[model samples]
Target: MLTRKQHELIRFIQTRLEESGVSPSFEEMKEALDLKSKSGVHRLISALEERGFIRRLPNRARALEVLKQPEDISAGKTAVRAAANSNTALTALKPALAAPREPANDVIELPLHGRIAAGVPIEALEGQATLPVPAALLGPGEHYALEVSGDSMIEAGILDGDFALIRRTNTARDGEIVVALVRGEEATLKYLRHEKGMVWLDPANSAYEPQIYRDSEVEVQGKLAGLLRRYH
Candidate 1:
């Protein structure tokens, strides 16, 4: 059986990976677990890893993947054990067998294409990396991730260095933030607006001017779905 702190840390890590596509940093884990120092968190994580509960991704910063959860003998299994076991042992296992099992959660890896500019239009680089996202973060559609490179969408709560989750779509509604490819060469993250046969890319921050283009100059690549931020 795992220690209390080990169980708590594993659950916390799983919750964080499921909620946000990123693992909690040492500082965040320390603060959440009420530990005095990061070394305590490290020891707990090491114990969990040694027990086959989680594994760290190689060459990735703060990347942790949960392998399996703590196992519990189900009521049916307990019943089978009772057939050949003593009444005292069956009675001892009754409480555990009565508890409901928690549903399994999943993590999804999204294609980490590259960075998209949130300020001025920049060349969207294509890469072969992937981001481990929670299945809960995406809906019924293909998805990808782009690291935000500028602060043009800061007012929209999208900040620089935040991972922008993109739901693959060639269409978007008016005033929705989208990944728009400009002239088939560069891509940008901005609000999409169509007016009188012209396409306008509006920024959330007033410091930047709106970019206007001909309808033929822009193509909708995807819609902004969510964001993941890492603590530095």
Candidate 2:
């Protein structure tokens, strides 16, 4: 059986990957588990790796992939049998055991417009790069991508270093996450809230404070459409 801390760490990694298509950084894991340092997080990650529960990508910083949960091995041949038969009820017992199938269509590529801060607003720079994304993850619109550069939207599962797919638009609904340009000088990703003719850029993490501005001071750049994360 996995220890309590190990279980928590694995679950956190799995949940983050499922939500953002990326594993949490060492700093993120440390903060999430209330550890004192990244060393503690490193040790836990090492332990998990040694136990065959996870594997780190070669030469990549903070790159991790979940191999199998502890319970999956415990289930033994029953789990193997369940995974082989699509119609078996045992297939429902552990969804992760099944392998992922690739899409038949070609992946779509989008322009990567450098990085955007999810914390404090930063000047959005245009970069000459492109990112390949699953066709299903994109919506109908002119779309572009920006690499996230802050933890302000961590609670929303958008972590630093993940690529955010944005649907080009100038309008967004209240409480929807959007890329907002402040006075055409800086750009940020936050929950858009309009109150009494004032615009509020709300961060998902409580450590940061919300930024409030006059409606005329901000312009909606794009709405968050999807997210992409590379293992490396």
Candidate 3:
């Protein structure tokens, strides 16, 4: 039987692979599992591998294959149901203990910075325009929107003409999509990676090669929060 952390890590890796064909980086796994350090993530991954639940690829970054998933969901649900059925007072109080969700009808206007290239680094246009967004689409944080300008991120379901919602932040973990200012001049939206003191900007589509730069040449401006596609 897999531990809770091992089960969660495998499930997360499987979901990401199904969506983008790229396994999440260790940093992402650490964040997702709420682990305090990458070393914890490493131990969980190693345990999963030893149990024949996952395997790693050679000479590749973030290349993990999920061999099997634990039957935790149904089992956990059954256990919860059994306990809830045994305790009437707890079940009566459960509804009141649940966290309230945000209202669905609220809207917020975000600054619409000009287009950001998905294929190559380009000058991001600064403007005074704003785009009104549904509040449910964004979480708590400062956000902005940028029109996508290339097809390099198409495989990740980010198309040209789509509005890329970005969260304002100067830091990002590996395998996250971010607005990277190149040499403080141009900016592009791509997967951010740090390896061997170099910043690697990776595209979702296989046709484009990954862009490598000195760590100092790339500055993370924001992380991808969500996407808004306008049908023409």
Q: How do these models rank on TM-score, best leading?
A: 3, 2, 1
Q: Which pairs, if any, clash in model 3?
A: none
Candidates' C-alpha lDDT: 0.72, 0.72, 0.72
lDDT of 2 by residue, 1-232 (tens): 6888788898888766544444688889998889999898989999999998887855545556676777743242111112112331211111122232333133567888889999999986578998765544454578898999999987766778877878899998887788999988899999999888899999989899999999988999997865665543
In lDDT terms, how accurate is model 3?
0.72
Candidate 1 lDDT tens digits, 68-138: 66764122211111111122221111111122232113457688888899999998648899876545434
lDDT by residue (1-232, candidate 3, tens digit) is 8777877887787667644446788899999999999999999989988987777754445667555567663221110001111222111100111111344345577899999999998995598898766555565678898989999987665778877878799998898888999998899999999889899999999999999999989999998866665533
For each candidate, give its TM-score against the true structure: 0.56, 0.57, 0.60
Residue 204's lDDT within candidate 2 is: 82
What CA RMSD would you report for each candidate?
A: 14.9, 10.5, 13.0
Model 3: CA > 4 A from native: 1-102
Score candidate 1 by TM-score against the native.
0.56
Q: Which ten residues in a row have the lowest lDDT in candidate 2?
A: 76-85
